[model samples]
Target: MKLNKYTWIFVGLIAAVYLGILIWVRLTNPVYLQKNMYQTWENSYVMHPKSDQSFVNTSKNNDHQNPVALSESQGYGMLITVRAAQKGWANQKDFDRFVNYWLAHRDYVGDQRQTETYLMSWRQYYNRHHQWVNDINSATDGDVYIAMALALAAKQWPKDATYYRSLAKNLSDDILSYEYNPQTGALTVGDWVTRDSKYWQLMRTSDVMPDIFMTLAKLTGDSRWRTVNNTMLDRLVDLSRLHHTGLVPDFAWITRDAAKPVKPNAISTKYDGDYSANACRVPMMLATSNNPKARKVLKKMLRFFSHQQYITAGYSLSGKRLVKYQSASFSAPIFFAVSHHRGEGYDNLFDSQKYIFSKPLTHKNYYDATLTVMAALEGLN
Candidate 1:
């Protein structure tokens, strides 16, 4: 059936109005746009487990094929929600749900299910048996972020300061006990890594979050946190100096004298040794630090990123581009990094990517959307 001219005109007007609304939203001020994005992000990803309404589900985004929750996602959710609460968009109730989800999924020791570890299990999934199961291991990245969130919550909501601080201190202690390499002062990937483990010396570049480590140090008064922060910063400087592009790899092996990119397929994937997804967070993480060493590392990276014609998904340490498509995961961090510096060069870089924070939500891109929100929260302020 053919539409009448009136019907065709009506359809055209509807499309035009929708397009106009999209443009208006994209052009709004940064803070307002960020709050909108955060709400959309929360609605799209945050879920409550059917078995336990009190616990939060962090991996309900469309990207995953089955329902699940990752410790990393929980960390992100907790931090994001805590910050959102301070801004009046999120509440203590939801924040408590995230905390409860973590508590209900703590990492265990052995077959008897010894639940001594305060650290959280890395993943929660529904098995084919239709039961929720945890991986029962801890990832340092997730643990660090969880500890940081708790510490922040202690200060942000003083009514519950004592409780949050206690939890933060306990988890921070365990992270030091199990995750830190005492001799090298570098973070191991997880509690599963022991002194004799082959992966003990491997460090993921994005885990070099000096500011968060410093926050943990101040909260717990642990001097060892300073060692972890300084050692990682030194390794980052060394890695940046090794490459003309100043790009850190997804994974690096740290020795007493130097840190080098891991060999391909050494850990998770062939991109493990390149500036891939994991390494893309380096810029935003480094931007959070006040140390001159962090600045030195970011300066080199800014130089490389500022000159890029298009920031793509992956690159080599030697300034070689590996992918053709641009990604918000890469650009948003660069945007945040540029926001920390002052100069005509940096300003232009910031302006070029400011629209990324305002991009309407896309389906099946959980990583990209999450990072974009994180970047916005940090950079827009």
Candidate 2:
């Protein structure tokens, strides 16, 4: 059949439009492209099976095997809402539902006469009996992200700004009161007020998110957060120096000396000062900082990883590979590191992203997926 002139014109127009879109997306900043692709990939993992309001980790790591982590769910909600606002996608309803679920289930400690409301349980476990069991202690990193999300939501939605800001402040206050170590001028890994004294001695380097601290400082007019931020920066450098490889350990031991404000005696013996899962986030956190020192540390770490033929899941402080298997969680953060520095390791960022993008997110691996999202977002920023 002979096509009409109008039909031929329509076909040409459609093809041109499609090609234009493809070129536009490809020509856009790589980080922005990554964010768009990551958002598409993340849609499959963010869902609620039981409560429409709440999201579950649902990755192979947690689905049916363990209870939902309030921290993880809240973190996911915050990330979604913040990204939605940035993209002008308007996701307030879903964000509100998530906030309500956790607010209703907020954890409290102390006796009936003297109770304190801490953050929600860090870990929630679903048993064979089909009940959710809540772990008492809270992870400070989760709390920080939730509070930051609330603050961002307030900024994004002006109509609910007052309510969201108030909630964020309350959460921030709880974090400051319970998690901040005045002696060390750093945030603890968990809630110190509720946990035993022994637990306060150890600090997770990844938990020292400078961006969150700076944001809270600006929002709350509190200099303590800024102080913690500085302390963490200096401590990161010190820890790297201690290891002599610019790689931080998963956990470091904090000892209070009369002469000094806070001293990291050594990497925690129990946690072993290794460049493992928790430590991998050091670069991601540092990449958020505009400080030159942070950049130096990140560049050093990225260069160390660049020498390896293949990035592994874990490593020793002395640049020894601990795990043979490569993981998105490990590689994505390295991508962020290299992207930020544009130094000797800049080429590595693409290699890492290429490896990450090649793998399909079928396993629903919570850590891997979350880090992948974070790496993508950080690189864009």
Candidate 3:
């Protein structure tokens, strides 16, 4: 029906109000919860800047104190890589020392529920608190080590296919259970079986994601996994591009109100994003194939990783974006990401050899990523 000038004015007003409400929800609701929750290490205006990450002390060793052990039933994927690398480097003694030291401290007892799902590190060391309050975050945690380990195992030693198959399938199922509403473009995780259940946990991109999940998807021949994982990648790109802090929301604070902007907050922990893992995993995803889009993401990750703070022992200097390097943290993933792009091995798939070299040829958590670079280089020919 045709409307008069006054009628049109009223309709426009109503539309403005509706749009305002939508913006409010996206910025303030659960979707935007993270922005207001944790005190960012980079920005303190949002929350009271506490003693969260006051300074940088790379020499500070966390070895003397035994961290809360995570899990023991699994683990050993990277060790195998080390086992293989043992044939090349004489640093076996040094690496094995860490491996054994970690093994001895595996969180085998006390608060068994607090143990992590995969990886030989995080859980076994003291995490103080647990995961986020998002289902997808929880699910991601639920299958981290299992997912990553399986992919590495399959890629490195194919004979272990059966070994990694069941584990990958199980971990994928767990990770998938948290993908209930993928329409919002988010990856969440958490388990909920009892009153003590932490059903939700949210997080931005980390080393434990993308590459591992994508690898699992390929191994299982399940496009669902790839679809969900890629959706995660898309959001990551958005956050990397949009967030003013050069990072993404660390806390999930999920609600029907996500997909909006964030607000200010109070009890801010070290809840900002980190370029280290994001730079590593995003580009790692590109090494498998030659997708032009994936290559772009890979290149972006390289630029990002090159800017982070890496204290000596392969630890993240701060949970925020990479602004400077004050200490000597042995950041190996940086090398690996560069490796894939430079094509370090016999050939060149991603041109990893152009950047990654022996100067910072770290063998820490980067071992897995390095192997990926090698494969990409070999596949190039």
Candidate 4:
């Protein structure tokens, strides 16, 4: 039957709404498992990055440029295993590989860029060093990854009470110099502002301040850190709610106007719409803590990041456009969120989710392994 003009309009509207809901579910669905902690830990650690036994050198011999596998980004994962250990999560072999890799790479020891070689990480943020580093500490995305690993470790095995404290100092010392705008309450990252850097456009995916400060505060007992962190997170929720769109743009621009609160020039990744990298951390943050507000954010995130393809069980190297991300992103965070959400008493994910992650090692595979270990450890619940 031929549709009249009004009928066509009604059908179009319904189709649009239906598509919107489908996308929403795909973006926010949680990857959860109902199992004991030990079982998940075993599954999570079942396949970690294999050591070439050459400290800092996981690359092949044939290449003239022998790139070291260890970097500050690896520290982003220390949270997983530390949480696992605290929960009595043990798969000694997997745990050992995770720790040994850290032990293998010390430049990542504190998460600061020790050399210019790491400008590459800056490249990850958006191809700029000063912007990513942001004048001294100022919350570089690299530092947060390092801080994340250690903070997660604070509650993990061997109980390094000093570990979290030290890492807190390391990350805090540099980032605190940032101009904390009490008005908008944003801890700016880059040297200036632009459409790409309003929120520190250096990254299309990482939220350096919110997760970093919150993690530091949680790991080291600093309320001030949370103040900065929650501001960003709350602001994020507010913006997304206003849009009525579950998707959180990876970047946005924060303006202080002529009032110019300290460093007034900047732009950030909040403009980016792709959910894969930007959305992974939301559920992980939500799952890791018992905070009421965090739970609320997690609920929204659960609705926002439900698209399962981007939230992989592991990285796929089949020449998929996103796979070339070099970040080795995906399933690791889902498992990490699952691991932590299940709490320190569970462990089935280590084995059950093993098949979802990558094996052997591929282009930039170390980071993927690092993320998986963290997710697995955090999945200790």
Candidate 5:
């Protein structure tokens, strides 16, 4: 049917009004902005191969190859899903799918029925037999994040709180039992770390998550969690004293009296001692804590970054930039830290880097993409 000129004009006016309202809501409502960002991130990485399960696949490596999944990524996805669900951007089913994937791929032995530990197997892959398999060991950091997410899920959904809380309690206990060093009060790299292992004394600096530790302590009524939190906080202080810029290493040796950065090629790469990929997360992680020592650590980091023209991908302990490229993983954390702790005169610095989050997420870099959205969600509050 043909419409008259006046009717067409009315239709155009209604469409314009609708578009304007959407733009206004997007610009003025942080929740709407966050939900939009979360949806983009979700659609980019989260995959559902079947009706009941889903996973966040790892992005291509330097070789341009990909893994089926990483437990670390699983933990990241679960935490983000649950947090987004709290904001109504996600739902219980979305969170449950991530949890189901973790359940289906837990650390195990010869038979899938035999549970090796509550901790998740760190990686998943397609075996030569065309069957799916997971690495036998568990990364402590992944376990920590998964446990924290479960605890949070319990609080977020009352009807299923018992189930979530039960899982959280068991995982938390196993983490303390297998991954934590009671004597040193430090978290080991993974479940494979034994006392006799040379790396047993080593702790990934990024594994020092005090806020998560406090949550676990409350969930399980464990004083040791408090001790672990304090021990790592003290280690950060000691490590900070080693450098004027207060940069931390990717890995550190936790001795009886001190925490020291590892030597080059000591753990993973030549940048082990440098503030590289792993250590890049320290700022955002510390930003989550209210502890005075945590705040002190962040202050030192912000001071160093604030003086820099750009926050590059990597840095040296002596405050030298290692890479010219900027990364969301590095910048988002600094942005979150600067925005989180206001009135420190770093507002201008925060403004400078806030554009990083506003830019389109790099789908090839899942770590950066996930962390960027997580930081954005955190900063929204």
Candidate 6:
């Protein structure tokens, strides 16, 4: 039967409308986009097989090399595994292997100058002279995430609940005793605190993980953990307001005076207040809180970055772009923050997801790849 011209036109209109709906769904549904990102994360970073039971380098030149499992990487891996397990993508056995690998390889440096716990060393190099160096110092953020992962694993695997709970408790206690400064309610960078030293007073803004602190607070029933979160949130908001741009510097010095309240000033005369590698995580961290102040800071940051063509690798506190390159690590958190804000006029969300999905993981870019995975996970949450 020959169709009339009107019938053909009507059919064409239906097809075009269908196509447009498909495009709209792809652009607007964050869950669908998150699933694609998760697949990219799993394919590029996660490794299989007992012999290779770790997140190995799959980016570029490092595939043949032994996996350099940094403490933060292990912590993030465990957290990712827990999430996957909760979603039925992984199992208890997989979670145990990842957790036990890091637990067994932890270093115990006895000296006061170095980290004084059985925490996993910060990094493990494949090089001959330095197969694995403790770096003598533990990163506060690494420990925070590791502790959070353990707390999560406890809930995920009830059969091993006692063991995981104890581990998480000890780590959390150590972090409080060693890293938390009662004098200023600030979590320091490492175990290098001295009563009268300026260096001991310095804090890495990225090291302040409010979400992990909130988790610890719930786990331990201790209000101190909540206090730490509150203190950090206050500092972050103050810093954002101080610069008048809603951007935070990577590092700041917290000064306590007898006559004045404790205040965080951007460290050093040379400190450019550039939101670079470390400060990029600020929005990601803050978005974990339901507090109005936290959301306000996150919204301001989202607004600052929303205007850019691409989220540059670095930016000054004044909203000036500092680097010519765009990075997944930087963009992922911004994507997360924008999603958290649930604000209007953010049509670039799909473009941001596209940039993140544009590359396959390679060995050489493990840091960025890990962060990309983390950001994608954050968006999924």
Best of the candidates, TM-score: 1
Candidate 3 wrongly placed segments (more than 4 Å): 1-142, 154-160, 178-186, 192-201, 243-292, 301-324, 327-331, 343-381
By TM-score, how accurate is candidate 3? 0.48
Rank by lDDT, descending? 5, 1, 2, 6, 4, 3
lDDT of 1 at 191: 88
Look at candidate 1 and give me any clashing residue pairs: none
lDDT of 6 by residue, 242-338 (tens): 6666888887666432111123333432333568777888877876677877877777777777677777888878878887888877877777666
TM-score of each: 0.91, 0.81, 0.48, 0.51, 0.89, 0.79
Q: What are the lDDT figures for the candidates, one per model?
A: 0.84, 0.69, 0.37, 0.43, 0.85, 0.68
Candidate 1 lDDT over 215-245, as tens digits, reads: 9889999999999999999998889988788
Better model by lDDT: candidate 2 vs candidate 6:
2
- Model 4 TM-score? 0.51
Most lDDT-accurate candidate: 5
Q: Please report how far candidate 4 places residue 270 from its true position, in Å.
A: 12
Residue clash pairs of candidate 5: none
Candidate 2 — which residues are off by over 4 angstroms? 1-43, 49-52, 58-67, 88-90, 111-118, 192-196, 256-271, 343-345, 378-381
> Over 4 Å off in model 6, which ranges?
1-63, 109-118, 129-134, 193-198, 256-272, 344-354, 358-363
- lDDT of each residue in 49-113, candidate 4, tens digit only: 35522122223431214333333333443444444455554433434454455443333212354
Q: Tell me the RMSD of model 1 versus the true structure.
A: 3.0
Candidate 6 structure, TM-score to reference: 0.79
Q: Write the per-residue lDDT of candidate 5 for residues 1-381, one digit (tens) a residue.
A: 356888999999999999778666654577767887789888878887678788887757411234478888999999999989888888999999989988887875333536566789998876788667777888988889999999999999999999999999998888888888877888899977888889989988888888999999999998989988999889988898899999999999987569888999998899999999999889988986989999898899899888888789999999999989988889888888887877887777677777665556677778888888887788866
